[model samples]
Target: MTARDEILGRVRKGVGKGDFAQRKIDAQAWLTARTRGPQPALAGDLLERFRNKAESLSSTVEAVADRGAVPAAVARYLAAQNLGTEVVMTPDVAALNWIAHGVRGTARAAADADRVGVTACFCAVAETGTLMLLSAPDSPATVSLLPETHIALVDASRVVATMEDAFALLRAERGEIPRAINFVSGPSRTGDIEQTIVLGAHGPCRVHLILIGTSS
Candidate 1:
């Protein structure tokens, strides 16, 4: 048998002997021993530190609610660019009424020449102005890719403290294992060739975030 198959066979045999529970207990004990310090509270200095870290990772953070015709603003921004009003919007964005803003929509990845892309962020980070979009049925991640310009509509309520917090939330939603999770910090950019930072090298060059807030 292959080495991998033999290893799996051995694991199966060991698991049949009820060793998995003992292993789990041992692992838990090891983890507890490693983290013996008391947990910090989520306020004041701790919160400030988290806020600072989040800002460093995010591109453009905004705080807002889903109300206030935010979708209209997204559409207006696209129209102003004379980009594709008939954009391939992410499924999350399609849930909103883009009709009010005079835009047709699709979920397909836009071509490089396409004018605009609209998407709803799964999370917004207040510390560093960043939006997080995860690929799913309603939010195809490719919508954020493949476009020249991308517009993200984020709700203030969805803002999180840090990437760690964001990953925790993602793990909760996806269980201990996930297929593909993409974390977009800002517009796709690279300064590799001549050390001259160029945007839209591998993905959308421009990223505009529309923060829909009940109280900014």
Candidate 2:
């Protein structure tokens, strides 16, 4: 037997299994019957709320009119920050016309030496200003983690109300979950050093978001 079978056999023997398939059904029923607990009234414009919360978490947000303007926006942000025009991107965003805008986008994994990474998030959470990324062949986890500067190009329509909404959307859309789901809230930071907060301690120090589907 494989390692999985071996471990599961031991579990079954220990637990004295009796209709484990029914248990699965019962678990699904329980999940379906579950209701959300009390949460804050997230009233008003979702985009405004998301932008405010993202900025509060140290993430810079920029709104563009449409997807066609994304490459130019990326170029502008890099130029302003003095970060080079060369950025690594996920395969989903690699097909963009980066060359026309004088920016080079490499569809590959990012390294520590890589300065900026351009990625499109699966969705952006308005509640906590978190970015939900479902990892796939086209969307690797390293592209967003290793780089010093992370530039996310997200559609404004994909911004959800809460963390629960994000997960609900995931379940409704993707049948089989991706292997890795990354939720990025601004840039990586830590406060372990003498109770003082430090940014870029573990990941990208700068997170610049290009929010599409809105007026600039």
Candidate 3:
């Protein structure tokens, strides 16, 4: 017998040989099963808990009436921060009339010079105040990673109580995982330098979230 086959035979014999194919099939079935484990208790209003947790992480949150109101809110934020009005956004949100609000919007991946990036999130985790973004053709990952400032638009109805709920939503909606899944809790920070906290060490220094279809 071939060396590989001989080794496998020896292992099977020592372990009391059984149906290898059936074992593989059973393992696959178990993986595909929608089995849930014990989760922590998360109470109270999900949206309110999400807002409080996000604010605690130093992320600015705003409530907008609908998708059409996003541009004006973005413009206001930029103006308030004395930042430029030009932003690179993912194709999913590029259809909004950003120019009418005195902000220029480019629907493409972010370039090094792009200071701000705007994209729509797949969901938000209320437990940790995290925004979950799935990367796809319409939702380029570069728009959120390469910019100095990241602005996310989350639908209020899409907020979930925990991370497990977010994953379940992903499986129910997308069926399979995307190329990349980003969970952004807040602006990037690092405390590795002499134990001193430093923001914007690896990613955006500022993160802003606009909750659509919610009252302020």
Candidate 4:
């Protein structure tokens, strides 16, 4: 047999005595009963806390009254930054009227030439101001990774209190975890050179978060 098959065979022989179905159920129960360790008590609303923490991590934050205002806000941000109007966005946010607000958004993987990219996070964590993104056919990771500027649209309702809470929501909503789960705190930075910090050393130079409170 092949090396991979041989290794698998040996592993199975060692632990294949019990009922796999029962083991799976037991493992699931254990996961459900898992408890989180001590966490820092954070006050204030989740959205505000998330915004404040994100800003501390060097991410710019803005809040919108509703989802319909997103495109205009994006345009305003681009204008303020003097960035190109053309953007690569995830399909999830493609419903926004980008063209009406003097922006062009293409739903696809970001190319090397793409300067701005827009995306929507699966969920956000208030404890660390971290964003969680699950990879899918419509939500390619590249849209958030390869651009000079990355803008994420977050729904206030999806904000979780902590990392553990975020994972719990993930497990509850998506029974099977995706192949890629990305957690981003802010812009890509590196302090590896003589302890001098540099932005965009490995990825996007800037990260902007737009929190949507309501869709109506």
Per-candidate local distance difference test? 0.65, 0.91, 0.92, 0.92
Give candidate 1's whole-model lDDT.
0.65
lDDT of 4: 0.92
For each candidate, give its TM-score against the true structure. 0.68, 0.89, 0.89, 0.89
Residue 11 displacement in candidate 2 (angstroms): 6.5
TM-score of 3: 0.89
Question: Residue by residue across 1-216, what tens digits does model 4's lDDT show?
Answer: 899988888887678644788778878898878888899888888887888899999999888888999999999999999997999999989998888999999999989999999999999999999999999988999999999999999999999999988988998999888999999999999999999999999899999999999433
How would you encode candidate 3's per-residue C-alpha lDDT over 131-170 as one tens digit per residue? 9999999999999988989999999999999898999899
Q: Is candidate 1 or candidate 4 better by lDDT?
A: 4
**How well is each residue in 59-98 modelled by candidate 1, as lDDT tens digits?**
3434345565766766666666667567777765666676
Q: Which stretches of candidate 1 lie over 4 Å from their true place?
A: 1-65, 108-114, 174-177
Candidate 2 residues lying further than 4 Å off, grouped into runs, are: 1-26
The alpha-carbon RMSD values of the candidates against the true structure, listed in the order shown, are 5.5, 4.1, 3.3, 3.6
Residue ranges of candidate 4 with Cα displaced over 4 Å? 1-12, 15-26, 214-216
Q: What lDDT does model 3 reach?
A: 0.92
- Clashing pairs in model 3? none
Task: Record all residue pairs in model 1 with backbone atoms less than 3 Å apart, i.e. clashing.
Answer: 55-127, 55-128, 60-129, 61-129, 64-156, 64-212, 64-213, 65-212, 65-213
